[model samples]
Target: MARNRKSVARLLIKAPVYLVAAWLLGFGFFVLTLPKAIPDGMTPKSDGIIVLTGGAGRLEAGLKLLEAKVADRMLISGVNPVVEPHELSALTGAEEALFTCCVDLDRAAPNTAGNATESNLWTQTHGYQTLVLVTADYHMPRSLILFRRAMPNATIFAYPVKGEWPMLYLANEYNKYVFTLIGEAFKPAPGDAGKQAKSATGTL
Candidate 1:
């Protein structure tokens, strides 16, 4: 009985250490697998483009793809509710005419999951079967997972925009990415509000 009690106490003490070690290992794998840049094989051609909000230069990249005639339509999901359409046109240096006919701004989605859900709806409305997803490289993994889950019937391609990021930023994003993966393992469907509390904080 005494030996059993001692063994249990030892196991309890090692449990947290094991967990921390496992987390560090997983984080290392995540960082190593992060996309360094958009690969040459990932062509720009798709029926539509999905530019997830909250990252610098993502909108411009998507617009450029559209301008290059890779995609017929572009959806800038998760646009701030207060941001006017005209303001986005100016910010992206895209002609207002493009926005008038080809681009759609989504202010309803507040996070990656919402972006996927709303983008799926927009694609269904437009009948776009193939889509290219654009977002910061650090965020591309989680975005892809949620997007694939949300639009399983749609052919989706990843177009991660690489950025120079500090280790802290990478670590923080890694945690969120892991969290998203874990949540997705059990959730049967994509949600409209994956991170509602983080909405006001921006860059959810």
Candidate 2:
């Protein structure tokens, strides 16, 4: 009886390690599957930078890239209609005329999926060949899934904005990726996300 109890205790002690190892292995595989991160200082040659709203630093990152001439245009998706161009200009520290000339504020996208929808429309209309997508790092995985579905032929580049509390952000993103993967099973294939929030720009 004592021997059996000791065996059970050992198994219990090892079980956690086994589970952790499995999780790490799974995470590694997921990370490996992702496209390699864009190298630092190599300015992206894209038609425009698509900035998905919501994250703290994403807008700033997009603005910085635009200021640096990484792209000629900028699309700030999921913008509040109530917020005028001047307001956004003040917020982004860019001139209102510059925003009007180079920026597009889209209110159609209220979530990540909506962002994808609006983004696809904007990109398609503008005849953009390459798109530099800016979003929070944790949100990038899900963004890729939705964007791929939305614009399969477009050369989409991810410009992941670093976030505070990266560890927590990563944990949240991993869980979101899992949820999105599972959700994909029920969703229709790419280019058919009409009413659903399946677009890349949709909420996380």
Tell me the spans in candidate 1 whose CA falls farther than 4 Å from its real position.
39-44, 188-204
Model number with the top lDDT: 1
Q: Give the CA lDDT, 0 to 100, for residue 184 in model 1.
A: 80
By TM-score, the best candidate is 1
Q: Give the per-residue lDDT digits (tens) of candidate 1, residues 1-204.
A: 999999999999999999999989988998888876665545657899989988788998888888888888899999888988789989888998998889888999978889989999999999989999989988999898888988888898888887787889888988998888788877756453555546756863
RMSD of 2: 7.8
User: What TM-score would every model get versus the actual structure?
Assistant: 0.86, 0.72
Clashing pairs in 2: 111-202, 111-203, 112-201, 112-202, 112-203, 113-199, 113-201, 113-202, 116-201
Task: Report clash pairs, candidate 1.
Answer: none
In model 2, the runs with Cα more than 4 Å from the true position are: 1-40, 166-170, 185-204
In model 2, what lDDT does residue 144 have?
Answer: 79
